[model samples]
Target: MEPRQTKLIIFTAKLIAFLCFAYLTLAFFPQYAHHLLLVIALALVVIGAGSLLKYKSQRNWIESEAKLLSSEEQEEEIAVSQYSKLKYYYPVIEYAYSANGISYTGHTLSHEKENLWVPEVNHWGDPTPATDRWWLWFEPGDHIPVYINPQDHSEAVLVKDMTKARRSHHLALLTGGILIGLIWLTLVVLNYTLPLR
Candidate 1:
C-alpha cells in the first residue's frame, strides 16, 4: 500500500480506538467518572511530558546539509512467543555530514518511533505482497537535511517528519487533558447540585 493509504488506515484505527475507550469509560463507569477523569488526565500529562523531553533533546541539534551514502533494506525475525515468528524490515541508511570543517557519519533517521512494519499476511492469514517498510526517501548522493549535535558533531540524524509529529502529539495531549478536566468539573457540579442519599 502507498504511504498515504497506510497513514489513513492508522489514523482511522486510532480514532476508533479512542472512541471505543471513551464510550466504554463513560457508559458503564459513570459512577467512577471522577476517578476515570483523573486517571485520563494523568496519562495525558505523562504523554505530554514524554513529548516535551523529546523536543528538548532535539532542540539543540543543528540542521545541516548531508549526502546520503547508502540505503539498504535489512530483514529481522522476531519471536512473538514460541509459536510465531514476525519478520520486520529495517531500512538501514548511512549519511555523511560536515560541521565546522569536521566530517561525520550518521545512521539515525529520527527520534520518533515509526511503525515501519506491515504484516506480510492479510487479516485472513493469507500471504500478501505488501511488505511495510521504510520507503527510502533519499538515494545515494542525494542532498538531504540532517540534524547534528553541536557538542558532538559525530552524532547526527536524518531529518524525518519529527517537528510536525511532535507538535501533533503535544496538541493531542493538551486537548485530552483539557477534556478530562472539563469532565471532572462536570462531575463535581453534578455532585453538589444533586441531593445526597
Candidate 2:
C-alpha cells in the first residue's frame, strides 16, 4: 500500500480505538467521566507548554556546520495498546561538529521528541521512507547546517524543529480551549448529577 494510504489507515484505526475507549469509559463511569476529561485536558496543556519551552530553547542554539558521517533508516514499533502496534520509520543520522575547539559527534536530526517519530503532529502521520526521507538529502562527508548548544557542544541537531515552532502556539491555544470546554462540561455534569438544595 502507498505510504499515505497506510498512514490514513493507521490514523483511522487509532481514532476509532480512542473513541471506543472514551465511550466505554464514560458509559461505565459516568460519575468519574468529568475527572477523566479534566486529566486529559491538563495533560494536553502540559504537553503543549513543554513543546513550547523546547522550541524556545532551540531558538537560542548557535548555528554551526557538521560533516555527515553516516545515515541510516530505522524502524520502531510503538504499541498503542495491548492489542495493537504501529510501525514508524525514521532516520538515524550521525554527524561530527566542533564548537569552541571541542569536537562532538551528534546523532539527532531535530530536538523535538515527536520529530523523531511523527512527521506531522496535526495529522498524526506515520514516518515512512517515502514520507520522511530527510537522510537521503545528504551524503557522507557533506557539510550540513546544524544548531548547537553553546553551553553543551555535544547537544546538536541537523534541523531546527520548525514543526514545534509553528505548532506549539496553536497547540497551546487549542488545549486551552479544550480545557475550558471540559471544565464547563464538568460543571454541567455536576449540576445535573448533584441534588438541588
Candidate 3:
C-alpha cells in the first residue's frame, strides 16, 4: 500500500482514539468533564506532539552544533534524523514492543518524500548514514506516542492501543447506555406488545 494510505489510516485511528476517549471520559466524569477536560486534553496531546517534534528537532540541531565545536569525534556525515522524541514524554513507555521485546524501539523517521535516507538508531553505537533496502523495512516514524509492554520489548507499537485498559473503559460506558434500552424494551413488552395477563 502507498505510504500515504498508512498515514491516513493511522490518523483516522487517532481520531477514533480522541472520540472514544472523549465519549468515555464524559460518560465516566460527565457534565463539564467532556467539554472541559477530555476534549481539551486530547487537543493538547495531539498538538503537543507536533510542537514537541519541532522543538526536539531544533534542540537536536543546537546540541549537534555544540558537539561539533566542543567535542572531537570521527568523521561521519550527519543526515536528517526522523521522528520526534515526544513519544517518551507521553504514556507510551508503559507498553512493551513485541518485535524486539522493547518498550520502545528507536523510531526511524522516513524522509522518502524529501529524498533522504536514514538508518535505524544504532544502539551499540551511533547510526550509520548509509542507506539501502534495509532502510525501507519498517514503517515510517510515528510522532504519536507509542506504548509497549515491558516484559517483551519487541511488542512495542505506535499509540492507539487495543489493550484491556482502553477496552474496559469503552465496554463500561456501553453497559449504561445498553441497560436503559433494555429497560425500555421490557416496559413496552408489558404495556401492550406481550400483553402478559
Candidate 4:
C-alpha cells in the first residue's frame, strides 16, 4: 500500500465515525441538545473542509516550486518522520505477524465496515472477533511484512501506512475526531446542566 491509499483509508474511517456519531446524537438528544450537536457537527465538517483546501493550495504551490527547492529540503520530510530507527526495512517478509507476548497470528485485512485496519486474520463481514491487534493491512496480499520502529511498537505499520498526503490526511482526520468528541461531550453536558429539562 502506498501512503496515498493509507491516508484514504484513515480519512474514510474518520468520516464514517463522525457520521455515525451524528446519527446517534440525533436519534437520542432532545430538541435543544440536538440543535447544539448539529451545529457542532457542521462546524467540524466546515473546519475539516477548510483544512483540506488550505492543504491543497500549499501542495500546489509546492508542486509548482518543487523543482526549484533544494533536493535536500524536498526529501527531508520523510526522513524526519516520527520514527527514526526505520533506517532499513526487510521487504522480504510477508504476512502480518505481531508478537505482543501472545504472537498474534493473522493476515492484514481491510475492514470495509470500519474503514480501518484490523488484526483479525479473517476478512470483513464477521463479528465476535471484534478484537484489535497491531498490524495494519495494506493492499490485498497475505502477511505483507512491514518494518516497525522498535522504540514504539505502537508506531509500527506496513508499507501501505504512509499514504499520499499523509500529513494532510492525518491532520484532517485528527481534527474530525477531536471535533466529534467535543460535540459529543457538549451535548452530554448541555443535557445535564440545562434547567429546561
**TM-score per candidate, chains pooled:** 0.46, 0.58, 0.25, 0.25
Model 1 lowest lDDT segment of ten:
111-120
Which parts of model 2 are misplaced by more than 4 Å? Answer: 1-33, 75-89, 113-132, 164-177, 180-197
Highest-lDDT candidate: 2
**Cα lDDT computed for each candidate against the true fold:** 0.70, 0.71, 0.36, 0.41
Task: For candidate 2, write residues 140-164 as lDDT tens digits.
Answer: 9999899998778888887666674
Residue 61 of model 1, lDDT score: 83
Weakest 10 consecutive residues of candidate 2 by summed lDDT = 119-128
Give candidate 4's TM-score. 0.25
Model 3 C-alpha lDDT per residue in residues 1-197, reported as the tens digit of each score: 96557987999999888789777766875543424333444444454354334333332221100001111111223333664321101110122122332223423222112122223354445655344323222333312334333444343333222334433444454444455445445644555333323
- Over 86-121, each residue of candidate 4 has an lDDT whose tens digit, in order, gives 121111112333444423322222211122333223
| Winner by lDDT between candidate 4 and candidate 3 | 4
Shift in Å, residue 4, candidate 4: 1.8
Clashing residue pairs in candidate 4 (N, C-alpha, C atoms within 3 angstroms): 1-160, 3-162, 3-163, 3-164, 4-163, 4-164, 94-143, 95-143, 95-144, 96-143
lDDT string for model 1 (1-197, tens) is: 96546977998998788778778866887565456566678778787767667657877788899988998876657676789887656577888889999888887876543423444565577775643343445479988889887788888776434555467767789778878877777767787532223
- For candidate 1, the lDDT comes to 0.70
Total backbone collisions for each predicted model: 0, 0, 19, 10
TM-score: which candidate is best? 2
